[model samples]
Target: MDYLDLKYTPKEDIVCTFILKGKEDKKTLSSKIAGESSTGTWTKVLYSKKELNAKVFSINKDTIKIAYPLELFEKGNIPQLLSSVAGNIFGMRGIDKLILRDIDFPKKYVEAFKGPELGISEIRKKTGIKERPIVGTIFKPKLGMSPKQMAENAYLVFSAGLDFAKDDENLSNQDFCKFKERFNLITKVLDKVENERGRRPIYAINITAPYDEMVKRAEFAKENNGNCIMVDAITLGFSSLQSLLSKKWGMLIHCHRAMHGAITRSRDFGISMLVFAKLLRLTGVTELHTGTVVGKMEGSKEEVVEINNFLRKEWFNIKPIFPTASGGLHPVLMPELIKILGKDLMITSGGGIWGHEMGAASGAKAMLQAVDAGVKNIPINEYARTHKELESAIKSWKGFEKENYNYKIKH
Candidate 1:
């Protein structure tokens, strides 16, 4: 059956753009993609409906845009939606490579799901950090930290003017640090910090587990006065995320994209990080880890900028997500990060803090000072001249200037 409709314009359909490379002709491959994703078989089906077929309405060389009828998807069901569009088409024969570059959901479909409960502005209000980028850190030596050690570190950073802290992606209920024990200790430390400093910093406790267990952990956190939770969004699956968001706990959901590189790093195959970011926003994550362009991440400056913009831009009733810049970040790179990503961001560092020459507290001070310099548009070197913590941090961590990363934001 012919799937291409050059004259068609998609109004209410879920439009997807894909890049396909195959031995079969472009027309044939595009037809197969539309058919297999929607409602066609290898042999002519005994019964079929023309209205259900996906329409390949636009094509430019190897790039094609296929629009699926909104009726094909169940309301607010991401698993079914992904299965229909992103599934089955990958393993098809004769197709050498395929990439799902981007997707656009109609207003009707987009409004069906609940987006972030507390988006960027609300989060800033809650944290009371208005102008500067929110500064945070991941616990270094991701695994094997005892509960006491973890709580002590939390106390150090939270008291040192850091706005946020999170458990590393791999940290979850190890023998050395049982979940309940760690939660108890950290919450106590946070309470102590709030009492002493008059500001309560956010601690994103990892509650990523099996669905039922995850729910139980979330309940535990809620019962014990926890304000935020983190999930490895990809590994936990979108269904779980939807269910968790549906609970309306009103807590900040920090999404850690741990295994995204496997799918997003490849240029010739698999899905794009942009698609993942959109879906996460739709599923209601308060904050997500978009790449740090100047840091040690796979995404380029342009790609990272695009993803960050999409996360924070207006979409129907969906609130803007706080784009988190993480992975190999340090105090030295603060100016470059704030310049490229803007001030509405969460800058997280791990080794950048804990690996400091003095200690974690000093490192936190240095990071905050660097952010202050960046916000005031002062040269870090010039600012460092008077700030002892920043000067020490610069002495310890150098070489960010040599990367020479640059980007010009488009109006």
Candidate 2:
């Protein structure tokens, strides 16, 4: 069977690039990958259909591009599409490593699903925050807290000048924190805070659970005037996200990459974070968690920048998804973060804010102060001279620079 067809470019085709590793030559491995992922098997069948095969149209060293036919996938079905393109081929024998580098979803696929309901611009409009990274803090002590406890913590963060506060990825409708109870209490707190601050605040309640239960929670949240809904996009699956997006809940969908490291960490195996981000964007995620280059995550400045750019760039009229720089972030790192990622971002801190010397309120104040400094192009240390919150945060948290960790950028 021939798996390389260079002349054909079909609108209904999905193009994917992968980093192949094995003893076999690039062409041989590419053919095996194309075949296994599409419609071929170990042994040649009696009948061969040309349209059923995935064609490897391009290859450059370890990177191979295979285009799968549109007829091979069901319309608007992400699960089926991934099953065909990102499925069983990874486990192929003798292939020491297989990394799916990226995917080019054809216009037909992009048009099939409703993208972000509240995209970057709309979200900024809602928050009335323009020309700065939307600052946010995660409700710390991720779990084992009651609805009242969580709402109180959220109130402190919101009132102290943060734009958003979210339930941790692990906290859903647990026994201690029932989703409805938690969401209602948090909504009331947000309302009170909004009146005091005279600005809208977003609270991304974790609506990740069984599909039906998740939908129920979403509806309940909407009825109670919740502004956003979060889902562990990688764990709950893209199809589930599509299900949520299809409803047009008029709420920002925060796509959390909770279990993505399992498939994205390896330099030589699994799929790249870029691929996941593209797919999630295509599937209508409003705010996606792209890692902070300076944070605890493994991604480098270049890699995270590339992902963020891709998410924000225009893709056939689909709205831009907001890139969130989170994980181990602090007030002290705000300027460097702005220097690297620019103003279009949601800078979130978990331990960075919660572990502050004063408390969550002061921590939230410090984050806003740092963002103010970053926006005005003022040096953090210089700005901290007069700002007590900023000074306190700087004195307490060493920030990402002190870690002294760096990665080599490959050509």
Candidate 3:
């Protein structure tokens, strides 16, 4: 089967960027990969077709771009599209190392999937926060807390001026802190906070489960007056996230990248988190976890900024999703994070908030203060002068500088 078509450009085609490293010649291996992913094989079958194969649009040194016809993919199916473009091509014997960098989705195929229900504007409007990055705090202890205990902790953070209080990615409908019971308690806390401070804080209840059960959990959240729901898009899969969006429950869908490091952490193999962010956005997640440059994650400042820009940009009329900078975030790093990502972001802290010397409430206060300082262009040291929480936070964890710059994992 023939795959190269330098002069051909389909009306609507899925473009993929790949880094090819192998023992065989680049052109030969590249064509073989394009064919293997699309409609070609080592040995021709009885019914051999040529026009239906993917075309190698261009090749630049070790980088190659392949375009697959839009008709080759289902209208709104992500798993099916992945099976074709990212399937058996990786295991090919000729290629020693292959990395799927990014995909330039065609407008026709992009419009097929439902984009975010509540994007950045909707989120800010709903929460009554017009500017500055929305701040969220994850319940520390991760698990083993009772429903009552978690709700009380959430109240502390929400009442202390944080915009969001979310469950950790691993927290599901566990028997220890049942989903129904936790939702009930958190809703009550939200009502109290609204009645007092008139702040419309949101709680992103974790609904990571089987399809049917996940739907049930989302329904329960809506019924309990919960404003948002969280899903582990990596482990639960984007297909399941699409199913959740189809229900049109009207709650903000927060996507957590719990297990994405396994695939995106590698520099020479697997896929990039940026690609995952785009696919998840198309599948209709209101907010997504994009790594923080100053955090413990492996993403560099350049990569993190690029992912944020792509998620928030207007792409084929698809709505923008808020880029959530999480994972080892703290008060000291807020000014720097804001400088890098800007105000149209959701910043969450786990140990950053909960690890404060004063308490979770003070930790929450410190985070907000940092955001205020960042937005007002005030130095953190000056901002900490008046705010006791910020002062305490700086006294505890100093130097927001990232430690050790290495792509490959050490452990």
User: Residue 89's C-alpha lDDT in candidate 3?
Assistant: 92
TM-score of 3: 0.96
Per-residue lDDT of 205-273 in model 1, one digit per residue for the tens? 999999999999999998998989999999999999899888887789999999999898887789999
Global lDDT scores for all candidate models: 0.90, 0.85, 0.88
Taking every candidate in turn, the Cα RMSD to the unseen true structure, in Å, is: 4.2, 3.8, 2.6
Compose the digit string of candidate 3's lDDT tens values, residues 184-294.
Answer: 988999999999898878899999999999988888888778899999999998678788887787889988999888988887789988889889989889999998899
lDDT of 2: 0.85
If ranked by lDDT, best first, what sequence of candidates would result?
1, 3, 2
**Candidate 1 backbone collisions, by pair:** none
TM-score of each: 0.96, 0.94, 0.96
How well is each residue in 282-365 modelled by candidate 2, as lDDT tens digits? 788899898988877779888899999998899886898799998878888888889999899998898778877888888989
Q: Which candidate leads the pack in lDDT?
A: 1
Model 3 clash pairs are none
Candidate 1 structure, TM-score to reference: 0.96
Q: Provide the lDDT at 48 for model 2.
A: 79
